[model samples]
Target: MQTVKNFSDAELITAIKTGTNIDNAVGFIYRSYYRMLENFVLTNSGNEMDAEDIIQEVLVVFIDIVQTQRYRNEASVRSFLYTLTRNLWISELRKRNSDSKRNGFFEASREKEEEDVSDFLIYKEAQVLIVELFERMGEKCKQILTLFYYENLSMKEILKQTSYENEQVLRNRKYKCLKELTDIIQQSPTIINNVKSALQRSK
Candidate 1:
């Protein structure tokens, strides 16, 4: 029987990027990271099926990251994959909670912390209106964007606050939140005008 070759981060990434023994590269990742990643999901309010799904999804994304030249060598491939897996599972938790509470979560969140996360975009009546829009999102997003726009923290700082395992993971979360917020603002004429008016006043 043949065996999957062990690869250092550099070697594995090179193989993936250069299309050398791509199958073996994948096999190495599965053998190396699947149990670790799957354990993360299993311990984090997920079932076996959920763990399997998350690990599979993480591998696909990790491979895509390599293929696209987006893999940064700052962290080991294992560490990066673990961070990716953990972040993804965290996101999946948010998603599952949001889905389960879709009917009332927004209103409930508002009731819990309507006054908190104030000065969300920046302090002002206009920003208050903006804050209201942010309130419609999930709690994780609210925390992430607030740290980003309000506290003006770097990704590393935000990771410390949010417990994100990697800067890239936090960056990805922030991007999605911003995109969602942008979509919401675009759909609202009142918010669009208020944002413009606020900028005009600030300038």
Candidate 2:
């Protein structure tokens, strides 16, 4: 069996709050709480990958909590970590469940009054279709469109995030992606009708 090192709760909290020996603190967390978190996720419909991702995010949230003075000794560090893991896993599960439920909602919702601008079905359908379209696109196209349209990242900022050789190439790629996406939307009568209906309702 491999030996895992441990850190006292107070010592760990102090290191994170003061931003000192942070790497060691993170390592300690992985070494100590990893199995407990992994088991919790495994039993909760989460896979190994999910466990890994949750562990990474939990550490980030934990550090933030400690640094922001949210850790006021109200709970033991182990308990806090366990709580964070449970909440995060539950949130992930909810998002998955909602996505499953959304398909039914989208299909059933068209019967509602289109004149109501706030009709949940039409708006949600449009948004969901946009996501579906993006998923069908190439990775670079999806990235460019997402950064520009959704994230509102500037060309220069996107350049930093992407491996494009220059701004012109990046912009050109974005344009092509946009054009492709637009063509797709136009080809889909269902998407087009829903979007137009939503727009008309809003106007």
Model 1: per-residue lDDT, tens digit, 1-203?
97658988888999877779878988988888888888877766677866765676566556645654446576677777776666555455554444552343233333212232222212432456657877988899998867655555655667888878876677667667765765576567777677657645653
Cα lDDT of candidate 1 equals 0.64
lDDT of 2 by residue, 1-203 (tens): 95655689998998877768877888988888899999988987778867876676567656645653446576677777776776656555644554553344334433222223123223433465567778978998988767754665656789999999987677566656765765566567776666556555644
- TM per prediction: 0.48, 0.48
How many Å off is the CA of 35 in candidate 1? 1.1
lDDT of each: 0.64, 0.66
Candidate 2 error regions (>4 Å): 1-5, 98-203
Which stretches of candidate 1 lie above 4 Å from their native place?
Answer: 98-203
Give Cα distance to truth, residue 129, candidate 1, Å.
Answer: 29
| Clashes found in each candidate (C-alpha, N, C closer than 3 A) | 0, 0
Q: Which ten residues in a row have the lowest lDDT in candidate 1?
A: 112-121
